[model samples]
Every structure is written in structure tokens, then in C-alpha cells.
Target: MEFTITNVILLFAVLLVIAVITTKFSSRLGLPSLVFFIAVGMALNHYIYFDNAYLAQLFGILALIVILFEGGLTTKWCHVRKVLLPSASLATIGVIATTLIIGFFATYILELEWLEGMMFGAIVGSTDAAAIFAVLGNKNIRTKLKATLEAESGSNDPMAIFLTVSFITLIQSHEMNFLSLVLSFFWEMGIGLVLGLLWGKVAVWMINKINLDSSGLYPVLSLALAVLTYSTVSFVHASGLLAVYVMAIFVGNSDLTYRTSIIRFNEGFGWMMHILMFILLGLLVFPNQLVSIAWQGMALALLLMFVARPIGVFLSMMFMKYSFQEKVFISWAGLRGAVPIVLATFPLIAGLEHSQMIFNVVFFVVFTSALFQGATISVLAQKLGFTGETKAPAPYSLELVSIGRTNSEIVEMTIEEGSAVVGKELRELELPEDTLITAIIRGNKIVTPRGTTSLQAGDILYVLVTKAQRETAKQIILEG
Candidate 1:
């Protein structure tokens, strides 16, 4: 049957509708949305054979950029700053350790060639940020632990990508020395860092300085900047993914105009990308091929989930003051998702020897991970005493709009059990001149707060304050 544009549109629309429905039920089923979308693609592939590794790899790269951009944009700086050191160590040194351990397993146990083993290690080393964000973001995990996981997942992709590319190059060229490869890695990382930082500052500056007539256009501007950040870094032979993530972190944390709007838009966009990328990756796979490697793949996946990942986490975070339960949760939270499958496409695209084998193995590993680890992460967190009741979004919302360079934001706080605001009258607690308590909600009723009105636990308060005053306000409310 010949495919036409009309037919394509109809088919895509149907698939998307199916995806939307699957997503609605995903959380209830204890499955990741990628699992459903991928299953749909695999089902479709039975009737329509679509095996274009290069195209799949391209789309995966693009999807990763969007996913990481959104990850960065949504990350709260206050939380990230607290765990930055440990998270950075995990993203960098943790990735290397995971690769070596997994590589050794693949080489000695699986009897794969060293280069192929290394490639496999690199492909699946990093926990997928999209997967981590999707799974843990819904859970009521401790803020610091969640931040650390998200930051590691968001940042480690660059290291894994670098190692994968280097291994692929090593196999393909066979002439590049270890010293040369090391230099190349550093070069990519350093350039990406410089470009990302510069572009992030520039993007914040641009967003603040240029006010679009319509607030709707701000999302577009932000997205364009994000794309530019990735592309500019890539053009200079740097890590484009890293650049986009870093750029988004800077811009998202800054007090740019339409910051809230931009974040909301990207959240939607990121989900779309996730669905599309997973479907494409699923279509690229041959389920029959996965069958042959199923046992080996499961072994590798188990090895990664139970052994290498735990070592990586424990070693990277050993010096930190995290509790044993927290460390265990961190170790178990290394859920693989589309990134490994996506990176699998790299070897295929590079035309490396045993590339198909690598792809199929990676596919099985990712499936195992998403099925086992992803499904049980929240439960494990709860069991390990790392989780609490998930916080509900505020019943209502308010925000202070910025016209230009203002850093003010509408901040929301819940009156915790021991919060200083819990028993105080509004008049007793001194706040900055720029800050104001817009409204308070207790249970289902809105309390019109007066100077004499006493605050109580469980009340939700929304306050407007400059960026500089946000921390101070939180302290006063929480610790007064």
C-alpha cells in the first residue's frame, strides 16, 4: 500500500490519541508512558516495517535536547544548589564507574569484545533524565534526594554521550590514542560549558530586554533560544545536549519575563517529544531479535540495576551525609529509559561492527529497566522511608508579572507543622516591603488575612517577593 500525506496525518493522529489515552492510565498501571507508546509502535511495526537507524538516531538526539531543556527549566535552583556537588560527582565520576563495571561484566561474563562491551556500557550508563523526572516527580520523595537524582540524570547524558562517541570512534578509526580521546572529551566538555554559560546569560538578557507584544510569543522565543544553544554548541564540536541543559538551567532560574508561561509551554512540549521519541525508537526495534538476546540482556540489565549502579551511587555519594536508606534509594533509582535505546542507535548509525547486536541488547536492557525499576521506584522509596505524601498543587494561584528586569515572583508556601508562621499574627512577622501575602487558604476556605488573623498549620500562603527576598521570606516563615 502506498502511503500518502493524508494517510500519514490520519495514522499519526490516531497514534497520538492512543498515546494520550495510554498516558492517562499509565500511573494507575504502574507503567511508564514510554512503555505504552513503545508497545504501540512495536505493534504497528509488525504490519509496517520501518528500520531506519540514522533517522531514529536523529530524532532521538532532537528529543533528548528538548527533554533536557525541560528538565533544566523545571528544576528549582534552591533545591539543586543544595545537592549540586554530589549530583555533579554522580553525573561525571558516577557515569565513568558505571561504564567500567558494566563493561567488565559484558567483557568477562558475556564474552563480548572489549570495545563492544565498552560501547554497551557507555550506551546504557546514565539514568535517563526524562524517565527519572517522569517517575520520581510524581512521588513524594525527599526534596534533596529527588533533586540529586534529577540533577544526575539531567547532567550525566553528556558524559555517556561522550564515552559512546569516543568508543564508536575508537572502533571505527582504530588510530585514535587514549590521550587523544581524553583530550577530545575535555575539549567537548569545556567548550560546551563556556558556550552554555555565555548563551544562558545572553538568553536571560534577551528575554528581559525584549518584551514581545503577546505573552504567547515568549515560549517561542525561549524555545528558539534553546535550539540555538544546542546547535551553537554542536557547531563548535562540543556537547550540544549539555549546552541546552545548562542554558535552560540558567534561563529558567533567572527572572525572565513570562518565566512561568515559558516553563508551562516547555512541559507540554517535552511530553510530546517523549512520546514521539519513544514511539520512533520502538518502531526501530525488531521484537524477534530481542528474543534471542533476552536472557543475556536481562542479565546485563540486572547487573546494572543491582550491582554497577549501586556501586556508582555509593562511591560517588559515600562522603556525603546521606543516610543509608537514602543511598539505597539512590542506587535503586537508576532507571534506564529511552536514552539507552536512543544511544543504541548511535552504534547502528556509525556502522560499527556488531552494532545490530548492541542495539538489540540495549533495547532489551531498557525494556527491563523501564519495566522493573521504573515501576517499583516509588514503592521502594516509600519502603525505604524516603517518601512522604505527595504535595498537591495550590488550590489557587497568583503571580507578579515582570515587565523588564524585575526579579520578583509569586512564591507559595505551606504552613508546616513547626513553621514559625503557624501561630503568629500577620502583624507580628516582619516581611520585606516588596513582599506581600496575597491570600491564604485553610482547608477549602479562603481566609482573608488581617493583621490580627493568626496563621495555622496546613494553611497555604502565596507571597510576592523579589528573587533576592525569596530565601529570606522562606526562612522567616519556616524558622521565625
Candidate 2:
């Protein structure tokens, strides 16, 4: 129980191990890991004694940067391209609509000042990328719907962050300038976008040109560049989180050396940040305070899920071409996670009259969202007929490690029944130029393919092909 460095480290390590172990139970119960992580933090709050709003906010922002960057890195441009416009609209206009709706409702429900109500709204406005990513990780949703949700979650934070800061200023200073606010929003977003794209290109070039002695250092280099990107953008009064996400998108999609390794490392690192952020947030809560605000928090959470989120989503995509079912699913999937809790710290730091109340409500809202919305995402997807066929990962894997940019890479394709390639020899199939079937996985055996080797149904093929011919090779193996 002593507050020493060794004790702190030991406590942290033990907590992490327990959190990791809880994932198995969480997954089995179809709940997001956040629930358990937060539970663990709350259970230890008595012994740990962590109530620093400033420190929690700082760590939350850092954790969010890594989490958002990882989300961007894993986002495929091809999938997001078609849904970009709708997603952007949701991220911006939808967020504003949601905030206003919730703010007005909160003003009447909680009898708070107008600005304070809006501040509460802004704090919980954006759908959390961390929560969305975690819940949808295994869900087989349609491509357009999935991409829209993912892209919106990844990009929506900037708008929410801007609004929260602006409202806090208005609340504190008791002044409002419409023109100035509009200009500031554009400046923050525009500068963040430009810087993200620019830094992404520069980072990719550096990674390829530097050619580090150790492959492990590639991840470190990326990690440093990400932090630098955020810090530099923030220094200029722009949205650092947006910049980080955009930069990661470029780095992830580029043909850089050790790209896979870098991505995998960030994925793991991002998970660690998620665990720490949620637990730290959980530690900040006092059970007695939560009980006092429990009724209001539950009412607000219900309003967000049933009323505000749906209205926001439908209105944002009014001109877009999405089915009613798709829209409904999207609305249901707006789960809140670390961002709202992080933003809640802002009010606390400002020492607002109702700041503690706001934090408790936000914390409760996030918990309810993770527990209810997170748990039912898959069932809703299926009920709405938006679920796609889920594929199990390949038992055997291959990575093409390189020290520099390479055109050729390994692609995996599963040979389903009724394929043209079935019962055909490798030499018999007219494969794409420069494409080679490196290995065939049949059941538990790894077959070293030869010219005479015959392909069969239920075979997983690893083909080495250049990016230019990648599609053609895929068509041949998968379709014919």
C-alpha cells in the first residue's frame, strides 16, 4: 500500500496482466474489453488513489493519438474512398447536429445553463474510434457501411474537440463571436489536413531512405514521427489529432519497407494504450458520485442512443444514398469510449461549477454505451441484413520483409468450391505475368507447389505478385 516507485511499477504490471486476461472473458460474453478494463480500474480505485484531472487528460490525448493513428493505418483507402463524402459529412455536420440536440435536451432535463449544456453535449458528441474499432473488429458488416462507420469515427474527434474547446471558452469568457468561431474551425481542420498529408509523405520517404540497421527500429521511428506530427500541429493551434490520423493513413497505405512490421507493432501498441486509457479513466470515478448522478446519466445515455444519434445520422446523410436499414445500423453503432471521458476532464480542469457532475455523467454514458451498444453491434448488423461473410484468418502466414520499397508482395486467396482453378495444375492455369504461387495450404499440410501440383477446393494459396498485376492474379485464382 506504500506509494513508492517499485510499488507503482508492480501495480501497473499486475493490472496489465489482469486486464489482458479479462479480454478472453469479455470476448466470450460479446462485450467490449473496455467494460472489464474500467471495472478493474474502479475496483482498485480505493488502493491506487488517482484523481488528477490534468494528468488523466494528458495521457488520454496521447493514448488517443496512437489509437487514432492505428485506426488510420489499418483503414484501406480503397474501402474508404467511396464512403469518404458521407463519412466526412457525418464527422462534421452530424456531430454539430448531435451536440445541439443533446445540449437542448440536457438544458431542459438537467436545468443547466445553455453553454454548460452544450459543453456536456460536445464532450459526448463524437463516436469514439477506440470503441468503434474494438466492437467492430470481428463483425462482418457490408463494406460501405463498415467503412463509413470506421472513417467517421476516426475523423469525427477533431470536430468534437473543436466544439468542446470553443464552448468551454464561451462558458468561461461569457462571450460568443460567430464569425470568429467559424474561421477558427476551418483553420484548425484545414491546417491539420495539410500538415498530415505533408508529414505522411515525408515520413514515408524517411523510412525508406534511412534503412535502419534493425527492423525493430522502424516502429520506433514511426512512433516518434507520429508524436512529432501531433506536437508540431498542436503548437500551431491546429488539430493535432486530425494530423496524426491523416499522417497514419498515408504511412499505412504506402509501399514502404517493413510496412507490415510497422503496422503490427502499432496495432499492439495501440491496444496497450486503449487498456491504459480506459483503466486510468475508470480510476478517476468515485462510486458514490456515480450513484448520485446515475438516473440523469442513464436518461442522457438513452437519449443519445435513441434520439440524438439517430437524428444526427439521418440528417447528415440526408442527401447521400444509404438504405434505411443501413442508416439505422449506423445510428445504433455510435458507441462512445475514451474520447468523451477524456474530454470530460476539460471541464474538471477548468473548475466549472458543474464540472464534476459533467465528468460523472460522461463516464456513465461511456459505460452504458460500451455495455449495451458495444454488445449488440453484431446482432444488429445481422438483423439489419448488413452482415458480410466472415473469414477466419489463415492458419499459416507469410511476410515479405524488405529494407526498401518493393513492388512484389505476397497475397493470400482462399480457393472456394466451384472455382475454375480447382483440379487444375499450376502450369495448366494461365497465371498473371511474373506471378508465382509460392505455397498451397491444404488442411494441416503446407504443400510446396510445383508446376505439376494440382489446385483443389478449400486450398489457401499464397501468391507473390507485383502491385500492378495484383488484381489480375486475384481474379485468376479466386474467380477462374
lDDT of 1 by residue, 277-310 (tens): 9989889888898888888899998999999999
RMSD of each candidate relative to the true structure: 4.7, 4.6
lDDT of 2 by residue, 378-469 (tens): 78888888877775675776774432344566666789999888998888878878888888899978999999999999998888876667
Which predicted model would earn the best lDDT? 2
Q: Estimate each model's TM-score.
A: 0.85, 0.87
By how many angstroms RMSD does model 1 differ from the true structure?
Answer: 4.7
Query: At residue 42, what lDDT does model 2 achieve?
Result: 91
Pick the TM-score winner. Answer: 2
